[model samples]
Target: MELTVLGDNAAQNSAGGGCSAGSCGSTDHQVSHLPDHIREKVENHPCYSEKAHHYFARMHVAVAPACNIQCHYCNRKYDCANESRPGVVSEVLTPAQAVKKTMVVAANIPQMTVLGIAGPGDPLANPEKTFETFRELSEKAPDIKLCVSTNGLALPDAVEELAKHNIDHVTITINCVDPEVGAKIYPWIFWNNRRIKGVKAAKILIEQQQKGLEMLVARGILVKVNSVLIPGVNDEHLKEVSRIVKAKGAFLHNVMPLIAEAEHGTFYGVMGQRGPSPEELSELQDACAGDMNMMRHCRQCRADAVGMLGEDRGDEFTMDKIETMEIDYEEAMVKRARVHAAIAETLAADHAKVSAPVMTVAAGTRPVQMAVATSGSGVINQHFGHAKEFLVYEASPNGVRFIGHRKTDQYCIGDDTCGEKESSLTTTIRALEGCEAVLCSKIGFEPWDLLEAAGIQPNGEHAMESIEEAVAAVYLEMAKAGKLEQAVITAAA
Candidate 1:
């Protein structure tokens, strides 16, 4: 198979080129984190600032109903009035209908400060539908902040498109970074026109997630990571999730317990996989306090959730009201499509110069394994502790061939940011034991020493290079330093 690798620099340079006026990659948060200035900006966003919950309100319009992946805990077709979880929207509207509903809701509830799309499906999956809605809102209701919640599989490619529409806040549902746990939570993901199952799917999903988060942060987008705390699965791992995303510059972390109600017709619910208790959830949030800010006011909202945090105004703006409401659909569609096409054209022209790298890895004299922490643009970019997975390649006399990856557990244990504790630290070292060398953007002294103590060469000083570029450099250096031959002898020992 031929190799195609998009360069890392293209992503960093391509951001914010088409953002709407006055919001060219600017964040609303102030210098002092959640101080008065920041609060005023986020005072109406119920999900981001805790103090905004009581007086502020938010609304989600479920315009995108097509999904690309299947979550074991989600059933999009089944919506119970008694149940409240993701994929349960009372009504799904078109881009035109959504804007009309937003107008009605905003007028009815003056407290509404933000408009979001947390889908009956992945918003990024239905990009045209989702962006069209944003285009209309940006022209009509520019004052209200626009937010979106996505699974992150398509986010890496969609960041430029999102910034073009001036999307201010984004929420990514990052359940777990470890694919062993991820394989249990997600059944399959449809990618590259194929349905990839098991750990392979999980790894691809994770790499895109970490990469997208980094790109969004670089573009000054306020990111909120939502982790569903599944008891006996990933409850204990969430604090580490918090640490890693915080390290990567996520603005906020919202850890919500899994809502596994049997009436919702979910796979986990049928299997009796229970959600964390209130106490269990609270303790996990408390454990993540010092390492990152935790959002305690999440109501585990539905896709069509409306009104304040605890209340529901979805019934007030139902399809009946939207039909009765007068709107210029033809004009709205024309404006939405016109702006969208123009921005897309400008973005295309701006990125027309970016090209993919001719990636290749040569064979070495002796067999050895190498790993890299990447943002999936084929470059070493992510911090050691924040790496979602390490791409492992086997170099032998025949040739260097793609092998597999080890989903690294986010390195911090409990509340320890530096990873000084021996237990979680030992687990990480053991996972990468036989690798001769590992390429990373940065690592702390304790973990660096730990890898060297285990005889794995830690190459923390390597500058940003593509996976092919880094592998070639490392292979040649190993050959010159006689490390590959020594590795062979050590294996014979």
Candidate 2:
């Protein structure tokens, strides 16, 4: 294991290199808090920066299909296209194939900046295929930021190789530090040519994870810790995990919900281990926020996911499609550079023009949750009828925070009499049950009335406006008009 430092030339030429200050977005408070060096690493990396997710896109190549640890929450499924979760991919590619797909995605999706290898299995467990892909990408696509997500069972050994390829970002899924709680989440781990099960395995895995985290941080590589919040399993235990990882110098902490739906067929899912409720997850994140930066916008993306967060475009660049289509790496890289520059310019302009509203709310006003319909780019531009999902935000006098998103059936299918329109609208409203307001570009008369009747305000006044600003402005309006107090009392009643 030979450690190497990222060169100055590579840093300057990386995809995030040339972006102006505030180019990521207006709500980039996490990035703003970072020191200049670490800030440069995450300002344009979509997964690392919540605000950058709107402007930049990331893709994961599924080249590693081997695992060293067995987690109760994960069941890696290949050829699983319909499911959108970690460890699920339609296909696994060889190192060469992964590089080719990376090139094609970069060429096609100009906003794509970060290329990660978060597998159908662990990248560090399959070090040969993993590092080979990274080696090639660093040579061919040096401008694209490279990252890897591992279970950390093999991370201590891979850190040197990771740094050798100029890979600056690493994600370690550290579910629990206590072996007792860990034994509940991970059943077995293959270590030292033998299968270790139960508490012994959990202890080794935890030790490796903590050591790898410290090793990566010592080398100046940005580390983001991902924890799955299982209701009875590790919910309360993750706070200590967060505190420990932050103490080890992890740059960010992402506390994601466990996807234990029985349909996924994992051990937890089949055994009726339920995931945390949205409220529970939010409370845990808030608790951990006192320790370090909490990542709220994770989509728990697939191994081969393409495009932005909350969206997948992997179907467009399948192996068959890549074989048929011709790609000119040099030319595409030039075009990508230009597109990134243009995006930075646009974001800078948007930030300068739209100042965040100042809200003078009465004391003790509860935070209001609002849903915004947006196709992408962090604006309230999507029409109500056209939205397949609504981005939910919680606005307080402190600031606006993206809590989660609610998926709903599309309301306005092209005019086929809309036979199921009423049912769809009902379901959509039900999905947005807690939200007090829905902001979008337009809403029809019928749905508008229905939303109002349900105590959810439908407002189209802030079309094409920044989502954070619009949410805050709406909250201020509600506070000024005495709606906040009434809503709280009504809910109480």
The models' CA-based lDDT, in order, is 0.70, 0.82
Instruction: Report how far off residue 47 is in candidate 1 (Å).
Output: 1.0
TM-score per candidate, in order? 0.60, 0.89
Candidate 1 deviant stretches above 4 angstroms: 1-32, 35-40, 326-493
Error of 1 at 8 (Å): 28
True-vs-predicted CA distance for residue 426, candidate 2, Å? 4.2
Candidate 1: residue pairs that collide:
none
lDDT per residue as tens, model 1, 1-493: 1111111123422432321111111111111234343344554477875434534678999999999999988987686554456788777899998988887776666567789998999999999999999999999876668999999999999999999998868999998888998899899999999999999999999889999998998887778899998998888778778878877878677888777766556888778999775447656765664455566557766788888665567887897976786755445545544543554354334235322222232343666678777653335776787665576655554334333345454223354432345665676677675687888999888888988888888887664765545665677777777765543553443
Residue-by-residue lDDT tens digits, candidate 2, 274-308: 87777788788867766666787888888999998
Clashes of each: 0, 0
Candidate 1, poorest ten consecutive residues by summed lDDT: 21-30
Q: Who wins the TM-score comparison?
A: 2
Q: Model 2 TM-score?
A: 0.89
